[model samples]
Target: MSFIARTSLALSAPNRIVETAGRSLAYRRFGTGPDLVLCVRLRGTMDSWDPLFLDVLARHFTVTVFDYSGLGLSTGTASYGKREMARDVDDLVSALGLTRVIIGGWSLGGFAAQTFAALHPHKVSHVLAIGTMPPGPMLKPPEPLFLETATKLSNTVADEYILFFEPDSAASRALGDASMARIAARTEPRDHPTPPEVFLRSLQASIEPSGPFPDPDDAYARFYRNTDIPVLALSGDHDIMFPVENWYALNDLWPTLFVVTLPDSGHGPQHQYPEMSAEIIASFVRHTAAR
Candidate 1:
């Protein structure tokens, strides 16, 4: 075989191990038992989470994860926003024949999960929200450095880089430069979440732009109200993306909200403190179930 053939074989080999979502998603499931669906954030794919951490969660219960619409293995464009993406989650559950789910979303995904639970309370068994906030500018703006980094990276990375390549390493694939509109069309579909070209289009919009931008789904409400299901909201102590103070706002919205604060972590506590994250989740699930 030619050299190109050899290279293609090697790359596909690693990915071959991953399962497909028929025509609707490209997701992987590990372990078995009750269902726990992990929702990815805006501009996020499954790669945003660490494999070792997934393994830990898998040990306790079945875990299902997929690239959100327009982002990862699911086929589509990448620039979609909150309401559309939330629809994607509902479609994903229906497509996968998931009748009941413990929906967990981090960052944007976390907000999405709450939104989903609020929108479809019967389908959602419980909710786990992490490091997330509503749309629109903050009452108090983010710290200068954090805002600077976010704006800089948004413009530079081609696409949002959840797990950016190291300075010494080669840059991420070319798809990071996909356009905003193209990315927006990637809803959870009947198959792979996004076509690779669409992924590339989303990359284009990641770069910092000079004008107006879309906000996350929840711009008006601090917390989703009047839900009866169990809820767990966690925020990292040092997270600049969504400061821990947001938890207080969340608590105000839902008086009985279960809140946990990680002492020394950043925006992605699940990735940064997997053991703690997992244990906390397990406890929440058990406590929720017992109630």
Candidate 2:
């Protein structure tokens, strides 16, 4: 199917429920090829993704998107820690009877993806982490201005622009506007907004110190280092929240890691540069699967 057609199908796709771990989870699957499951970012639902971006990805791989427990249409209390979040994803995978899947996680989803690969290495074939930092002491906190803008319950278009795109780039701002338009297009049976308390818990879990890793500084190192699984990490050059430097440091730790930085973009590089992002991810998945 064409990109536009696939995107429309995704937006209008009926909700599918699967019972896993004593919880009813909502999920949607699109396209065909190697299995590629996407873990949503903080405060995001299954429908929060940009249609164009998702379409671009769906064109190349079979993509699965789902909500965290207690968020969106899923049932059960949400967990804050990435390990627990990873477990939720693993359950979803098992519920769907998928194996040897490629996982693409954005922002907080990236953390969960890493944790999942670490905890269940046999199920994962490749890891693609976007606009995320490795769990370690060297990670920098989000900027005060960015944090203040993002924490607002009702963020204006300007606030969202600042939070997702580079402030000084008009082109980037235009892409952000287009992304918002696509996200807003899913009108029927739209997902419920994540509760404030749940969002706060997830954010706190994302920033808090790790509880499962033996060494916080080497949390991800133990998982990806010397592993055959191809890891592709990408970020926006102007990401104020996690910053591209964090990803750079992560690549430094694993020399074999494939890393890319999208120019003139911020936290949501996939939204800002969907075609390039999808192309890179598709290439990485195909290359890794061929091995």
Candidate 3:
């Protein structure tokens, strides 16, 4: 591997910007091989990702993580709606001159990833989602605990455990601690956190049903069924926000969907097991790539 690709620069990679769609998007690009553009979760900035996870992904693909408009270090209006967010990803991809790339995200960002693929299928090679819900109504609703912990102005380690990792598991809690430490170890200038007010507005927007982002004629389940693009949804055994059961319910409906549930994991499977998660993602992309 080359120096830029081999060296884990997730902690120190210079932040870059590109003018797109009347906004200046702040992003970090690292790794090698295929392009992997990962969107951030709700109330998350570019700094929210675990450094170890990015480092592991860097080994196999050129990864790009960015801040959504009006959040973190980016400029312009921000909308929590997935279609609107997908527009940001599309603009960034065009500005970067990337032809086809794997679009991925965590939590709310996952919604944007799926929408982006549905909207601009020609520009996407694969859809990689983590800790996100399936389309249509869920078999089970999100736990109340998620909203209580997620909307906090600032989260403590304990709050993180509850929100991301399996709080009751000793092993998961330890992994969560390590992941948080790795994230904190990035001493370079980082993006700012999503403000409490902005995030609160986002929370409301997410709850208010805004319909499908795919096609006007296609509903939520129909979009997944018709889309031919390969999708990999990585989740935990217990996700307080968007449970794995919801995806399982529609397992046979999504033709190219691959779902993996990590044992003793929670919302942040990537954080709990960064190396394993990255390998799973890399393998998925390599195995699903076009011939």
How do the predictions measure up, each by TM-score? 0.68, 0.91, 0.93
- Which stretches of model 3 miss by more than 4 angstroms? 1-7, 210-220
Question: What lDDT, from 0 to 1, does candidate 2 have?
Answer: 0.80
**How would you encode candidate 2's per-residue C-alpha lDDT over 148-193 as one tens digit per residue?**
8877777789988898888788999999987887777786767778
Per-residue alpha-carbon lDDT of model 3 for 1-291, expressed as tens digits? 334233458988888999887889999999889999999898898899988899999999999999998899899987888877899999999999999999998999998898888788899889998999767766677899997998888889999999999999999999999888788776666788888998788667656553333324346557678887888989999999889997888778888889999999999999999999999999998888532
What is the C-alpha local distance difference test score of each model? 0.57, 0.80, 0.86
Model 1, span 1-291: residue lDDT tens:
333233321112222122224334566566566788888754566555544455567767778777665455555545545555567678778777789899888876775676677677788777888777543335434455544454332344421333221122132222222212223322322233344455445545542242112345343344345556777877766566666675666566664478888765556666555567887888888777413
What's model 1's lDDT at 154?
Answer: 37
Residue 11 shift from truth in candidate 3, angstroms: 0.5
User: What is the Å distance of residue 30 in model 1 from its true position?
Assistant: 1.4
Best by lDDT: 3
**For each candidate, C-alpha RMSD in Å?**
9.4, 2.7, 3.3
Model 1, total clashes: 40
Query: After best superposition, candidate 2 residue 209: deviation in angstroms?
Result: 4.5
- Greater-TM-score candidate between 1 and 3: 3
Model 3: lowest-lDDT 10 consecutive positions:
209-218
Off by over 4 Å in 1: 1-23, 134-140, 150-223, 289-291
